[model samples]
Target: MSRRLRLLFTALALAALLWLLFAAAERALALAQRFLALPEWLQWTLGSVLLVFAAAGLSVLWWLLRPRRRRRPLPVPDRSSLEQRIGQLRERGADTGALAAELGELDRRRVSARVYVALFGEISTGKSSLIRALAPHAQVASDARGGTTREVGHYDGAFPDGRTLVLADVPGSREAGGEAHETLACEEALRAHAVIYLCAGDLNRSQADELRWLADFGKPLLLVLNKADQWTAVERDKLLARLTQQSRGIASAVLAISAGGSERYQRQLADGSTESVERQRKPAIEPLLQALDRLTAPGAEGLENRRENAVLAGLHQRTGTLEARTRAEEAERIVRKYARRAIVGALAAVAPGSDLVIQGVLATGLTRALAELYGVKVSDVQIEDFVQQAKLTLRTGSSIVLAVAGNALKAFPGLGTLGGGVLHAFAYALIFDSMGRALAASLAERQSLDQDDASARLKELLADAGGTRLRQLAALTIDAVRDRVD
Candidate 1:
C-alpha cells in the first residue's frame, strides 16, 4: 500500500480502538456504580446477572441492526442475442429501426462518460424551473411561459455522494413539430441515460400517444405532473387519477410537483447578471432527485433491466403492427398466386388422388413464400420437408375430420372424386390462409423454431381456424379463384 493510505488506515484503526475502549469504560462504570449500591454478596450476584443480560442484549442488537441482503435483480436478456434479433429486424426494415440504433448508441455511451438525464414534457410544464433548481449553474429561463425554451439546454449537477451527471432540458413538445426542430427532441431523448417527462392538465388522446412513444423508447423514465403548486389537493388527485388511467402500460412512476412555486430560484437581472432568490419552491424537487439518484446510480439492476425491456417491448409492439399490415397487403396476393397453381395441378390429375396432389403443391408453395417473407432462407428440400410436416399434421388432426364431414361427396360414393371441386378448392384456400396467419404471427413475435416443434405448430395452425372463420376466409378466396378462372 502507498504511504498515505497506510497511514490513513493506521489512524482509523487507532481511533476505532480508542472509541471502543471509551464506550466499554462508560458502560462498565455505570454497571459498577449500580452494583456497588447493593449489599456486597448481592452486588456480586447481580453483577454476574447484569453481565449475562448485557451480552444477550448486545447479540440481539447486532442481529437486528445488521445490513440486510438486497434482492438480486431480474436477469437481463442476452445482449448479443438481443442485438442479433434487432439486426435481423433492421434487415427487414422493422418499425423499431430507430430504437434499435439508439439503444446501440446508448450502450456505447454508457462506457464513455457520465449518465445524461434529460427533462422533457410539453410546454409550460416546468422543465426549465426543474433544471434551474437542480443545477443552479445551468441558466434556464423560468418565467412560466409556454414554449419559452426553443432548444436543448445542458446543465451539470452532482449527487450527494459526489457522483456527477449531466442534466438536460429539452425544448418542449410545442416546438417539437416545427421543421427546424423536428428531430431535436427525439435526438435528445435518444442520447439520455434516463428521462423525466413533465406534464400538466388532463392528457388528451394525442398526448397519451406521445407518452407511449416516450415509454416505447425503453429508457429509464419518470413521468412528472408539473405545476402541482397551482392545483388544489382534490384537483391534483383527480388529475393524477385521470393521467394514471390514461398512461396505463407506460411508466408507472407518475408524480406531481411544482419546481417554481415551492422553492427559491435564480433569475437573470436586467443587466444580465443572475440573482439568487427564494420562491414557493414546492415542486417536490427532493423526491424527484432521490428517484433520479436511484435510477442513475451505477450498476443499478432496475435501471438497466427497465431500459432494455422497454426497447424489447417497443420492438414487439411495432413489429406486430407492421407485420399485420404487411401480411394483410401481401399474403392475399401470394395466396391467390398459389391457389391458381393448386387448381392447375389438380385439374391435370386422375380421380381419387387429384385433390391430394393439389394440397401438396399448394402447401409447399405457400410454406416457401411465407418462410421467405419471415426472413427465412429455405432451399427446395426444406420447403418440401415443411410441407410433409404439415401433411402429417393434417392426417392426424381435425382438418380431415372436418373435410369428410363437410364434404357433400360423401353422400354420393360413386362420384367421390368427380364433382367436389369447389369444396376441395375452398378447403385448400382455408388451409393456406390459416398457415399463413400463424407464420406471420410467429415471425412478428420473433419465435425461434425447432424442427421438433414443427408438427405441433402445424397442428395448431390448422386447428386454430375453426369453422366460422374458415368459412369466411374460404368464401373470399374461392371468389378470387373463380374470378381468375372466368
Candidate 2:
C-alpha cells in the first residue's frame, strides 16, 4: 500500500474511536440533566437504585475474573498418634522402616540449624543448570537427556546477604519408567525448608498438580521459569504474567531465569576451518536470587515447624497407604481360610442339600475376625446379627449360588469325576467366599458394619460366577474332599 492509503486507514480508525467517545459523553450529559430535572426524592431513589445495580455488577465481574488462590493448610497428624500408628504397623509385620526414618530425619535436620532449599521440576527443566548457577564452585552435571540427575546431591550455596544454605539437586520428575526417582524427588522436597519449582515453559496438567501437591504441605515455595534467555523480552513478560497468574496463592512468587545451560556452536579457526565449540550461556538469575533472599529470610530455625509438619504429613499418607494394603492382604487370607473350612464342613455333611446352609460357627468366626482386623469393635450380639443377615442373603441367592457351582463342576471336568457331593462342597466354598469378601469390602469402606451395604454386596457376589473364580473354588473343593478322604 502507498503512504496515502495507510494514512487514510489510520485516520478512519481514529475517527471511529473519537466518535464512540463523543457519543458516550453526550449520553452521560443527557442522563445527568434528566436526573437534575427530577424531583429531589425521585432523584435520590433512582440514584440509590443505580448505585446498587452498579455495585452488584462490579462484584459479579470481580468474582468471575479474580485470580484463583488454591493454597490449603497442611493437616499434620499428632506426633504421638502417628508414632503409635507406625509402631502398630511394625507389630503387624508391615514395613515401617521408611516411615520411622522420616521422623528421625525430621529431628536431625532441626538439630543441624541450616536452611535447605530443593530444586524441583520435571526432567530437562534446567534444575542441574540452575544448581551450577547458584553454586558455581560445585561439580554439578548437566545433560541434554532427561533423568540425568538420578539421586539427590547437596551443595553449599549463599544468598546475596551472605547467609549460607544447603541446596539439594534432586532427580527430575516425569521421566519414562521413573516412578521411584520421582518419589525420591518428592520426599526430598518435603524435607527441605523451602522449595524452588523450576520449569522451562508453561505448566502442564501434571506440573500443575505437582505444584498444588507441594502447596498442600505449607512449605515456602517459589515457582521459577528457567532458560528465560531463550524467549524475547515481550514473550518472556507474557509468559511470566501467565505463570504468575497460574501460581497465584500456591507459590510465594513466580519469576524467570536463564540457568546458563551449555550451548554448542560452530566457530571458525584462524586456518579458515570450522570447529564445534561448547560453552555455557551466561545466566540471568538476578530475579531468582532476590526471591530466594526474601523467601529464606526466616532461616532454618524459624522454618523448622513447617518443615516438620510437611515431613510428618507426607509420612502419614505413606503409612496410611501401607496400612490399607497390609490389611487388605490379611483380609484376603482370612476369607480364603474360612472358605476352605466351609468346603470341608459341607463335604462331611451326612445329608448334603441342594441349597447352601452356612455353618453358623464358621460364619460367626469370620465376622468377628474381619471386624477385629479392621479395628472395629463389635459385641457378640452384633456378631450374631451380622451372621443372621448373611444367612438371609444366602437364602435369597442360594439357587443362583448352586447353579454357578453346577456350572463350575461342568467347567472343571476333574471335579465332576471326584463325586456326587463335590457340587455341595463347591457351593459351600462360593457362599463363604462371597460372604467374606462382601463383609470385608463393607468394613473397609464404611469403617463399621452396615448390614444393608454388606447384604447388598453379598447378593451381588453370590450371583457373580466368573470363570476364574469358579476354577479357584473348584480346586479348593477338590483339595478339601481329597484331604478329608486321606
Candidate 3:
C-alpha cells in the first residue's frame, strides 16, 4: 500500500476509537442522571459510574492532544540524478525531427553557391518592393506600418553564374520597442552572409534607429537608400553624401535606389520608352553591387571565414533554445523537491513528546503555511491525505493534536484570536520566504548552464564550427554574389 493510504487508515481507526469512548461517556452520564431521584444509595452508585466515565473521557482527550514523534529528514536528490533528468529532457527535445530538418535546410542553403542577399530596415522601407523587382515570383507582404514581417522570409533564385542566391526579407524595425526584435532580425541577416539595409527616401528618426541598431551586428552592410525618385537631384545627392560620409569610418557600403523607379525602368525596356526618362529615374544600385564584388574576392581568406561564422551562429541560436527549455524543466523539478522537503521538515518538527504544545503549534502553523503557499485550503482531511500519501507514521499522534488545536482556534475566541494571527504570519514566512528562495536559486543555476566561452565550443558542437575558416568563406561568397549582381 502507498504510504499515504496507510497513514489515512491509521488516522481513521484512531478517530473511530475516540468517537466510541465519547459515546460511552455520554451514555453513563445519562444513566447517572436518571438514578439521581430514585434513592440515595442508587444515586451514589450512579455518581461513581459518572466519575469513572468522566476520567476515561479526560484520558481519551489527553491521548488525542499528545504530540507526535519527530520524523527523520528526507535525503536530498543527488547532482547526478538531476543531471540525468536534464539529459532526458534534452534527448526528448532532440528527438523532434522537425527541428533537425529546419537546421538541415539552413545548412543546405548556406553551402548553395549563390549570392544570399538579405533585405532589412525600419518598417515601410520598400524591402519587399526590392525583392519583388529582382525576382517577380517572390511574394512578400508590403505594408506601410512598421514590423509587417514577423518571421524571416526566404527567396531563392539563380545568379548569372548558375549559383543560386537565397534572398531573405526580415521584419521591419521600429524606433522604440524594437531592439530585441531587430537584434534577432540582424542576427538572421548576419547568417545570410550579405545585408541590404534598405531605407525609404524620407529617412526619419525611427529609420535612423533601425540603421544604428544594425551597425552592432558587424556584418558587411550594403546601404540601399531606396525611393530616390521622391527627392530632387540636389536633395538626393545631399542625402547620399551625408549617408556616405556617416559610413566612411564604418566598413558599410551605401547606394541610393528607387524600387518604384526600377519597375518603371523595366516597363521602359519592354516598350522601348524614352531613353532620357529611364536614365533620369535609374538609382545607383549598380555601384553598390561593384563594392560587394570587391569586398568578397575569390581565393581570399575572408570569404571562407564568413561561411564558418554563419554555421556557428545557427548552432548558437539552437543551443539557446535548448538552454531555455532546460531552465523551465529545472523550475518544475525545484517545485517538486521543495514540496517534499517542506512536508518532511514539518513532520520532524512535531516529533518530541514533552513539548506537545509547541509541537502542535508548529505543525499547525507549517501545514497552514504550505496550503496557503500552494493555494490550497487547510483541513484535517487534507493533512491526513498528505501524510498518507507521504507514507509517514505519527508516533506521538502530533498530527491529531495539531489538527485539534487548529480546529480549537476556529471555535474558541481567545485561542482563535491568538493562534490564528501568529500561525498565519509564521506560515507565510516559512513557505513563501524560505521555500521560494530555494526554488528560485535552483532555477537560476539551471539557466546559467551554458557552454563556457571556449572558441572550440561552437566548432565541437556545430556541423561546420571552424570560426576563422567560416569567416573567410562568407567574405568570399559575398564577393562572388556581388560580382554577378553588378
Candidate 4:
C-alpha cells in the first residue's frame, strides 16, 4: 500500500473506535435513567449496597500493598538483665574501647529494646548513602573520599512495626594505617542485632575475604549491591549473579539499590532567569530496609548467642594486642641492657682484637638475657653455640662493611680511637638489637629455624638497619658515653 493511504486508513479506524465507545456510554446512561424512574427508596438502597462492596475491595488492596516486614512484639526486659551482662564484661577483662561500647549499647537495648543494625564495608563503598536512603531523616556523617569517618556514626530510625532502631555507619577498614579504625568497626558489628555489608559494585579477593571474616561472627548479614542507578540492566544482572554466587553460605540475603544520585535539572525563576540545579534522586532502599527489619525483629533465632560471641571475640582481640605489645617492649629493654654494656667495652678496647673479644662475650650474655625476656631458658652450652655461630656470621658478612664505614670516619680531625670506638659501639648495639628481635619472634612461634634460615633472617635485619638508623643509634650512644665519662 502507499504511505498516504496507509496513514488515512489508520486514522479512520481510530475515529470509528472512539465513536463506538461514546455510543456505549450513551446506552449506559439511558439504562441509569430508567432505574432513576423507579421508587426513590429502592434506588437509594441499591446505590448504598454497591458503595459498600467498593470500599471492601479497596481495603483489601491497601493491606496487600503495605510493607511486608512482620515482627513479633517485643516483651519488657528485666532491669537487672543488662546490668548483669555489664558485670560479666568487667570480670572477663574486656577492657578495650570497642568492648566498652558494646557493653554500653547492649545496656541501652535492654532498657529500651532497640534493634541496632550496623553497615560495614571498605572505604567509598556507599555505606552512608545506604543509611540516608533507608532513613531520609537520618543524621549520618559521610564523605566521598576515604578515611573521613574516623568514628562510628549513630542514626535513629523506626521500622514498619513502630519498633525503634539505631542504625550505625561503620567506617571503612583493612587498609594500611587503618587497623585501629577497622578494629572499632568489627566491635560495632558484633554488638549489632544485624549487619549490612555494603558494596559499590564487584568484590575483589581482599574484600571477599573480609566479608567472609565478618560473616563468621554469626550475626545476620544482608549483602547490599549499591549504586544500581549507575549500571546498565545487563551489567547489573551479571554483577548481581557473581555477588550472589560469592555470598552462597555467608550472607543471608543480597539486594541491589540506588540510595541516592545526582540529576541535572533546570529551573526558571519569577524574574525570568533560568538556573541549573543538581537534584538528588530519592533512594530506592525500601526493600533493603524491610529485610533488615525482618532480621532484627523479636524472637529472631540465635540472637542471644550472637551478642555473647561478639563480646568474647572483641575481648580476645584486645588481649592479643596487649600481649604482643608487652613482648615487644620487653625485647627492647633486653637489647638496651646488653647494648649499653657492649658500648662501655667498645670504648675500653686498646687493640682491634680486644674489641672483637669483648663483643663475643657480650653476644653470649645477650643470648641468655633475651631468652629470659621471652620466658625461655637457654643452657650454657646452647648460649656458647649461639655465640659462636653469631660471631662467625658477623665476621664473615659484616666485618668489611663496618671497617670500611668506620675508617671513613677516621678522617675527621680530633677523633682518633674515640671515633672508631663510637662506630664499634653503634655496630654492636645494632647487631644485638636485630638478634634480640629475631629471637623474640622465634620464641613466640614456639619453633626453631635451621642455621641457614636464621643466618639469612639476620642478614635481612641488618640490611633493614639502613644508614639513617645507624646515625640515630650512634648519636644516642655518644650521649651515653659522655655520661659514663662524667
Candidate 5:
C-alpha cells in the first residue's frame, strides 16, 4: 500500500475511537442530570445501590488474589519417646550408637545456652569465606577447590549487639563422590538454632529441594546469594527477584552479599621482577548481619524447643532406616533355613512327582516366622489363604522351575549320580526360596501380608534363570544330597 493510504486508514481509526468515547460520555451525563432532577429520597436510594454493588465487586477481587499463609510442619516425636525407641533398636542388635550420640549432643547444646547458626549450601558457593567474614578473629580455611572443607567446624563468634553465637562451618554439598560429607552437612544443619543457605546465583532443582527440606524442619532460615560482585545492579535485582519467587514460603528471608574471599595478583618488585601476592578481600555483609540479628533475637533459650524438635526428627528417620535394614537381614536368614528344609523334605518323599507340592505345615511355619519378624500379625486363616494362592502360582510356573532345575543338574554333573531325586530336591529349593523372598519383600514394603502382591512377586522369582542364582542353588542341593547319603 501507498504511504498516503496507510496514513488515511490510521486517521480514520483514531476518529472512530474518539466518536465512540464522546457518545458514551454524552449518554452518562444525560442519565446523571435526569437522576439529579428526581426527588431527594429516590436519588439517595439509587446512589446507595450503586455503592453496594461496587463494594461487593472489590471484595470479590481481593479474595481471588489474596496470598496464602505458610502451612505448619509436622510435629516431631517427644524426647522421651525417641529415647525409648533408640533403646528398642539397641536391644534388636542394631548399631544405635550414632542415634544415641545425637540425643546426647542435643542435651549438651541445651545446657551450653549458645545460639548456633549453620552455614549450608553446595560446593564452591563460598561457605568457608562467609564463615571467615562472620567470625573475623577465627582462622577458617578458604580454598578455591570444591569441597575443601570436609568436616563440621564450630567457631565462637558474637553479634554486633554483643550476644554470643556459635557459627558452624559445614562441608559443602553436591560434590562428586561426597555423599558422606553431604550427610554430615545435613545433620549439622538440623542441630543449629538457624541456618544460612548460601548460593552464588539462582537455584537449580537440587538446591531448591535442599532448601525446602530444611524449611520443612521448621528452622529459621535465610537464603543468601554470595559472590554478588559479579552481577550488575539491574542483574542483581532481577536475580534476587527470581530467588524470592523460587523460595517464597521456604526461606524466611533472601539476601545477597559478597563474602569477600581472598584474591591473588601478580605484583611488580623494585627490580621489575613479577611476584604472586595474595590478600584477603574486603567483605560487605551488612544485610546478612541485620537479617541474622532479627532472626536470632530470640536467644538460644527461647529457641531451644525448635532446635530440639529438628534434632529429634532427624534421629527418628535415621533410626527407622537402621531398623528396616536389620529386619531385612534377619528375614533373609529365615528364608534360607526354610529353603533348606524344603530340599530335605522333597528328597525324603517316597513317591516320585513331576509337579511341585508346597508342604502345607512347613509353608505355614515359614510365613508365621517372617510375619513375627516384621511385626505383622496374621491369623491362621490368612496364612492358609496365602499358601493356597502360592500353590496356584506354582501350578502355572512349575514347568519353568523344573526346567531350571534340570539345567542345574546338567551344569553340575556330580548331582546326576546322586539319583532321580536330585532334580526334585533342587526344584523344591527353587520354589521355597522364591516363596520366602516374595513374602518377605511384600511384608517389608506393605507392612502386611498382601496376597496379590506377594503372589505376583513369587511368579517373577520362579521364572528368573539368572546364572548366579542357579549356581547358588546347585551348590545348596549338592550339600543337601551329600549329607543325606552320608
Candidate 6:
C-alpha cells in the first residue's frame, strides 16, 4: 500500500480499538454499581487503568496515522542545452542577409563622409531656395506664404566620384512649430556626408535651435548666410563676422550667398559689371564638398567589407534565435500534453473498482507508483493508465493464486474463511507488484514520447530559420543559396 493509505488504515484500526475499550469500561462500571460489594477504591483503580490504556492506544495511533509530509520536486536545470541553442542561433544569424543590407547602406555612405545642413532663420530665409540652388532637381513644395513648407524636406545627390551629399530644408524657423521642423531638418543634414546650414542675414532663437541641432550630428558642416542681397556690403560683413565667430568651433566653412542675385554675382568683372549672368555661383557648396572628399579617402575599402559582413551576420543571427526559441517552447508544450494524456489513461483503468474500499487502496498505490516512475506529479492519473494497471494487476493476481493452490489447500484442509483471507492478502500483494511494473513501462513510454516531440519541434524550427535566412540572402546578395535548397 502507498504510505498515505497505510496510515489511513492504521487510523481506522485505532478508532475501532478505542470504541471497544469505551464499551468495556462502561459495562464494568455498571457491574460494580449493581454489586455494591466491591470497594470504591478498587472500582476507581480499574476505571483509571482502562482510561490510561485507551490514551496510550490513541497516542500510538496518532503517531502512526499522521499524514506523510511530501517534499517539493527539485528544479531541473537545462542550461547547457539552452546555451548551445543560443550559440547555434548566433552562428546562423551571422550569415543572414539582413545584416548584409545594413552593412551595404553603411558602406555606400562611408563612415567618415558626412554632412549637416539645416534650412532655417527668419520668416523668409529662402531655405527652400537654398536647397533648390544646391540640387536643382530636389523638389521642395513652396509658395509666397511663410508656412508653405510645414514639414522637413530631405534630398540626396551624388558627385562625380560617387560621394553622396544630403540636404534638408525647413520653411520658416521663427515660429515654435517651424523651429521644430527646422530642428528635424538640421538632424537630417547632420547625418549626411557633410552639413550645409542655411540662414538669412540675421539670427533668431529658431535659427539658434537649428544650429544647436546641427552641432549634435558632429559631422563636417558649412554655414551659408543666405539672402545677402538684403544687407549692404559693410553691414553684411559685420553680421557675417559675428555669426562666423559664434559658429567658429562648428562650421568647416562659412560664406555669404545672394539667393536672388547669385547668378549675376558670380559673373562680376573688376568694373562691377556682370559678364556671365546665366552661370550660378555655388560659394558654400564647393568648400563643403572638399571637406567630405578628405574624410572618406582613408577607410573606404575596409568600411565596404565590414558593412557587407555585418549585414549578413545580423540577419542570420536573428532568424536562428527566433527559430530556436519557438521550437523550445513548442517542445515544452507537446511534452506537457503527452504526460497529461498518459496520466488520464491510467486513471480510467482503475475507475470501475472505485466503489470497493480496497480498490481505493489499490488506486492510491498505483497512482503513487506511476507518479514516481514517470516523474509526473499530477493530482489524478488518466482512466487509460488505470485500465492498463488493473488488467496487469488482475492477471498477476490470478497467476499467484494458481501457483500457490496446493500449499493453500494443504494449510486450510478445506475452503473456509481463514483460507479465503490468506488468499486475498496474497492476491493483493501480487497485484501491487504487477502495478509497479506497469507504471514503470508507462513512464518509459512517456519519456520516449517526450524525446520524439522535442526532436520534431527542433527540426521544424531549424527548417523555418533556414528558409527565412535563404529568402533574405537572396534578396540582398548576388550569390545566395536557392529557395529549393533552403
Lowest lDDT block of 10, candidate 3: 449-458
Better of 2 and 5 by TM-score: 2
Candidate 5 lDDT, tens digit per residue, 1-486? 999999999999999999999999999999999999999999999999999999999999999777645646657987788789789878978898899889889999999999999999999898888888889899886444653788899998888888889999998888888899899999999999999999999999999999889987888899999999889999999999999988888788999999998788999999989999998888999999999999999899998989988898888888789988998989988988888888899888776452334377678999999999999999999999999999889888879999988877887767766767888889988988899999999999999999999999999999998888878878888888889889
Per-candidate Cα lDDT values, in order, are 0.65, 0.89, 0.52, 0.71, 0.89, 0.50
Q: Give the alpha carbon lDDT tens digit for every residue of 1-486 in model 6.
A: 899999999999999999999999999899867756767887788878989999999999999877544222222224344345455545644333432343345445665454423454555656666666666788778654653567666776555577665655655555555657644443334334444566766666656655654454344456777777668989988988988766766666677775542343356688887665575454345543454456445434433343333333333344445654544444333333333332223233445543244445444654554454344654444533554445544544455434443243344333324434333333333233334333444444464223233233322322232333323222322111122125
The weakest ten consecutive residues by lDDT in model 6 span 476-485
Residue clash pairs of candidate 2: none
**Model 4, stretches more than 4 Å misplaced?**
1-113, 122-126, 143-150, 172-184, 229-235, 260-262, 265-275, 298-302, 349-361, 404-427, 444-452, 460-465
lDDT tens digits by residue: candidate 1, 270-385: 99999988756544677677777777876433355455454454445544565566655566567656755654554445677767877886777677776676666667887677
- Sort by lDDT, top down from the best: 2, 5, 4, 1, 3, 6
For model 3, the stretches where C-alpha displacement exceeds 4 angstroms are 1-89, 92-102, 136-151, 156-164, 175-187, 201-218, 245-251, 261-284, 295-304, 321-325, 352-486
**Clashes (N, CA, C under 3 Å) per candidate:** 12, 0, 30, 0, 0, 44
Better of 1 and 2 by lDDT: 2
Runs off by more than 4 Å, candidate 2: 1-59, 67-70, 141-144, 265-276, 351-358, 379-386, 409-413
For model 3, how does the per-residue alpha-carbon lDDT over 1-486 read when each residue is reduced to its tens digit? 999999999999999999999999999899767776588987788779989999999999989766533222222234344345445545755343433444565567546645566787877677776676655587776444542676688886443344455678887777366577676676567566667878766456765655554444345567778888788899989888878755543435777777753333434466776543343334445554465565544422345345435434444455446655654455444444443333333333444552334334434444344444333444776544433322222333334424433443344344345433333322222332223333234324433212122112222222222344333322332333334347
Q: How close is candidate 2 to the true structure, as a TM-score?
A: 0.85
Candidate 4 C-alpha lDDT tens digits along 1-486? 999999999999999999999999999999899989989999999889989999999999989775544222222233355445445545644444553565576666656655678888888777777777666687677553552566898898777777667788887876568788887788888777788888888998877987777665666789988888889999998998999878777777888888784567889999999999998877888778778767776632336556555555655555456556666676777777776777778778888589888887887777777677556766788777777777787778686447544643444334336755677776676777666666657665663423455556666676673565555556556666787789
For model 2, residues 1-486, the per-residue Cα lDDT tens digits are: 999999999999999999999999999999999989999999999989999999999999999998776777679999999999999999988889889888898888999999999999999888888888899999985444653798899999988778999999999988988899899999999999999999999999999999989999997999999988889999999998999877888898998899997888999999999999999799989999999988988889888889999998998899889999999999999999999999888877786552344488889999999999998999999888988888887878879988888888997667777766788788889998999999999999999988899999999989997888878888888788878889
Query: Which of candidates 3 and 6 reaches a greater TM-score?
Result: 3
List candidate 1 stretches off by more than 4 Å: 1-75, 89-100, 120-124, 128-164, 168-191, 197-225, 232-256, 260-337, 346-353, 364-431, 438-486
Steric clash count of candidate 3: 30
TM-score of each: 0.43, 0.85, 0.47, 0.66, 0.83, 0.32
Ranking by TM-score: 2, 5, 4, 3, 1, 6
